[model samples]
Target: MSKDPDLELVKRFKEEGSLESFRALYERYKDKVFSTAFAICGNYAEAADVSQETFFLIYRKIKRFSFKSRFSTWVYRLTVNVAVEKRRSRKEFLALSEIGEEVFEHTGDTPLETLERTERDALLNRSLRHLSPKLRTVIVLRYFQGLSYEEISSILGISMGTVKSRLFRAHRELSPLLQRPPFSAPPGGQEDAWQGN
Candidate 1:
């Protein structure tokens, strides 16, 4: 129920420089690290690279970390920043296969329904490119990860007010793109197919 274990692992690794302790940390957090990266970039290769870089940073800089912030928050900040930096100028298109069904698993009524869900997720991800990095970060943390604004602010080292403002601007910019023609549900699907932002 508590995250104190991560801190304990960090301390153990710092003191003993144990590979087992390092592996323990990576095994525990790898999914969260990878998912956050993929949720933001929407690309598997890019997300894997970001996740690798995050663990690399953790291994190298764990000693410098002050523990002023929670280890999870620090890890997220590093992962998100690195992921965003890696894909900053690249507009690589992601195929539906690259993102798993988790991104498009709302319903599986039929092949047509699955295709519709994939397209809907694809469109939403593509639209995310139009958002500034800060805005996208806020959106991913809030919508994809279901994190509270206070948690996001703590992770990103920003004010809660700034998080709200970014979300507002992001919604404003994303509204038209999201409401465009491709959003119409497939023939067998419901009227409003796309749910998550």
Candidate 2:
């Protein structure tokens, strides 16, 4: 297949009902779609279902594609939307009560090191989970998927400024989660107390 052949295949499929064209498009984008879905859904089974649903929707709606953007970007946007909707629907069944506070406990040699690492990772995850879906999506697309801001804007159907704003907000929200422990005292306090000078 040629570069951007999926777009041509989709165009052909819409015009001629060509199964070959559809198969080619599927082969080209299957992994990308599945990977995007899996990144958001975080489960192989749900990701598989989301991937199938995404392609099914694409097939039904292929005629509506106007070629205003890359087909891959359009498909990725669909995948993200589908994954987010699935997550929202499942949220009610999966309560947040199970998120235990014992995450700081250490289980290996060098307890302090283990504790620090675990706590840091947990705090990051918790902060990410607290972000709005829009902010989280941008962070995931830019950082986890390594997409450029333009690509992310295309995928999300938003202006570049919106992408920048959401990423800035995500980072701003995460900063406190990564800052110094709230109860830590100044360095000189303990030294002054011991010296009594």
lDDT of 1 by residue, 116-173 (tens): 7777777777568667778888998898778788889998889999999999999999
lDDT winner among the candidates?
1
lDDT of 2 by residue, 127-184 (tens): 5555677887898788867878998999888999999999999999877645746233
Query: What's model 2's TM-score?
Result: 0.64
Candidate 1: stretches off by over 4 Å: 1-5, 88-113, 183-197
Instruction: Name every residue pair that clashes in candidate 1.
Output: none
lDDT of 2: 0.71
Cα displacement (Å) at residue 81, model 1: 2.2
Q: Give the worst 10-residue stretch by lDDT in candidate 2.
A: 92-101
After superposition on all C-alphas, the RMSD of every candidate to the true structure, in Å, is 6.2, 10.1
